[model samples]
Target: MSDVLVIGAGPAGLHAASRALDAGAEVTVLDAHDLVGGQFWRHLPDDRAAADEAQLHHGWKSFQQLRVRLEEHPRCRVLTGTEVWAIEPEEHGAAARVHALSGPSGALRREEVLLTPERLVLATGAHDRVLPFPGWDLPGVFSAGAAQALAKAERVAVGERVLVAGAGPFLLATAASLIATGATVVGVHEAAGPSALCRGWLSRPWELASSARKLTELAAYVTGHLRHRIPYVAGSAVIAAEGNGRVESVRVTRLDRDWRPVARTERDIAVDAVAVSHGFTPRLELAIAAGCAITADRFVAVDARQATTVPGVYAAGELTGIGGMALSAVEGAIAGLEAAGGVIPRQLLAERARQRAFAIRLERAHGIRPGWTDWLCDDTTICRCEDVPFGALSLTEGATQSLRAAKLSTRAGLGSCQGRTCGRTVEEILRQSPGLLGTTTTDQRPIAAPVRLGEFARE
Candidate 1:
């Protein structure tokens, strides 16, 4: 059996490992979390397992089946609480050398492991992309991802009165989860308006059939919103959050086609908490370290077979693109089968194509618009880690020309996060500036994930 290392145990990784093992390969699935499921299937731990875990998630049963099968498979090794910190490229057709630490991250003792697998699969997934506004750094303002996660995994309400604001179908689900957690949802808001939605979801009606497979889930969220009498507002956003120290209320403003705020259309809404998300940003550090080709749009570049530019390396899931779970799983299956030397079935190819179209629709429907910057005042916090404001970036001021120079001068992305949270936003702020963009990109990090100095010394 050939050694196959899958660098995540999310939906994509699990499917990939299962398919690879079925094709007669030895698979080792490494996940950073304590459990196999990534964020999508995240739930309470076994000790505090939810009595109705299935209620919080959409595909709990299927996830359980695949997860159980992999854990018990003779040719599989599922390593939970293991994080790959770096990938060193090999010169002679060898898979990248993976450097990792395994154990409870907070615990004092953690074991380091180095593996040289013949094949590698990366499904590191994505993080929530929040376009910053004034007072976004406040305590009660939460990213849409964090809000849903708290409600789903911990059964914790973000606030007694919560307002869900963001683009994409995800806002509906977030509102549903908030309501489930006993939060009084003031409303559900979408940044994209009816026109964008029509262009994205209705323009190519035939292609939507591929995505319609999950329409039931969408319908359920919509039904819940209606049943609860939650107003669904479109073409609007929370322009500014306000409070003394934490968020108390937000200024909601109508936006134009380019996402520019419409004058005199702003209104203040009182809410204890604000849950917001514009879209998602792909996690590409592992792929970048593995020397895979990234697209102009910053996603990992993959072909019809899910092969990366680097030999013996494959990519799937959100890193490849912002397609949903079903798309990621299909890509994973294809990558695993091909990596294991199994011929991919024709139906998988068709499904992948359908999913790709759906991703395009998603991009059109709810993707971030350039005019989102209009939401930012000069005093708006750009990098929460560094507490740097928009005016400090000076993208249009022509003071510091390069991204690196600006980051250094203002200490924007050089903070504790190492740019994971604000790097893309800083880049976007630069992109809009035109003259501020430099050869340096915030995407590349020498260390994919955080490591202790001791861990680095061990390596």
Candidate 2:
């Protein structure tokens, strides 16, 4: 049994494991991917040259240092290719047991492992939040993060001509990555107007000024945009995609201040593929199952020490909120120290406070407005996994009040992906509906990811 078991190997989990080990705790880190670095530092193929690898990922040096330290730490053990399916909290002072399948996801022979740890840190991270648009279910359409992952992990281009559409700084990053892969990026459409983004930065000049490193990182994206002469469409969205079994072109529309499509502003842009993402939503299933309190904004709520409402269960990174790497590191360090029975330093707390304030500004600037719902036609496939159309989701006035109610009525979130892809769309639809005003909650499940029946039998 380890003193601390961190579920995730991202920046937060890595830092948390290091901190706990520093405090003389036996630390074990588990990650689903075979690599220690999470999506941000997605590892390149081993055959790739070091120079090529360095060119692809930023913060490679920092990640290398962390990886080396963790690997050398005698008290620390990092397990890759381990998918934690369930966390069973024990009563009467028993340590929590983390149930996991140890092997590649689709492997024929996977070992079932139960880890009992005194404290658990969840750094499960966030996933791309996608809004449903017409033809989104077609091939060649993927989330911006998915495009980045493919380029980073597989060294594959999503398409010859790709149009990246989304909101937030991530869009620029994805565009830059796609351009690096020699893809012909037609344009990058952002739903938020430039003025809103400018105001978000202006509102917190101190935070902006402190983010010199972030600005420096963004310089490459700006350079790529200018060099490629890619159209950076502000206050714009891809209203619909058209293709024959695969995306061929997208209809871009000028969005108003509230992100509603403007009339007579639709323009067709030809592209082989479209990458779209609104923002990020925290992966809160494990936290919710651990009985952590959720904030009004729907992220897992944590205290000053990063401890969740549930005892012995702490959360960091995007699980708290999508505050990027720096904030996640700070929160993870604090959580690790506290979880290992060490006092958190005042400086770390102050840093966390500053980063959190900046995160609020970011969230306000990139938050998805409900007006995108206007783009959905009655026949648009909102739940692609279940083939549930927008028209099928008819709620009687005041009849459906919750996400579960809506899901049951339309069978929208019941597919194999299990609402990971379509839950947000369903929630947004219900929120925008005139009769439904109930709070949207994160969907909770017994298993975090798909598990084979044989694996369960082994357990």
- Model 1, residue 238: distance off in Å is 0.4
lDDT string for model 2 (1-459, tens) is 339989999889988988888788888899989888888888675666346676777777888888899989989899999998887777655346778888877898888878878899999999999888999989999999999998877778899999999888889888888877879899999998878877766675876666566667778779868988998988999999998889889999999878999999999988999999899988888787777889987888998789888889899999998888888888989988888888788998887887787788777777787788889898999888889888777533333576777777777888888888888778767766666656656468769878878777776
RMSD of candidate 2 to the truth, in angstroms, is 1.9
In candidate 1, which residue pairs clash? none
Per-candidate TM-score against the hidden true structure? 0.97, 0.95
Q: What is the C-alpha RMSD of each candidate to the true structure, in Å?
A: 1.5, 1.9
What digit string (tens of lDDT, one per residue) describes model 1 on residues 1-459? 677899888889988998999899999999988888888887888898877778788888989999989999989998999988899997765689899888988566689889889999999999888888888899999998899889878899999989889899888888988998999999887989889989988896866655665677888888888899999998999999999888999999988878888999999999999999888988898899899989998899998889999988999989999988888899999999988888899999998888888889899989888898987888888989889989888643553577887787888899888888899888878767656645677888868777888778866
Q: Count the backbone clashes (under 3 Å) in each candidate.
A: 0, 0
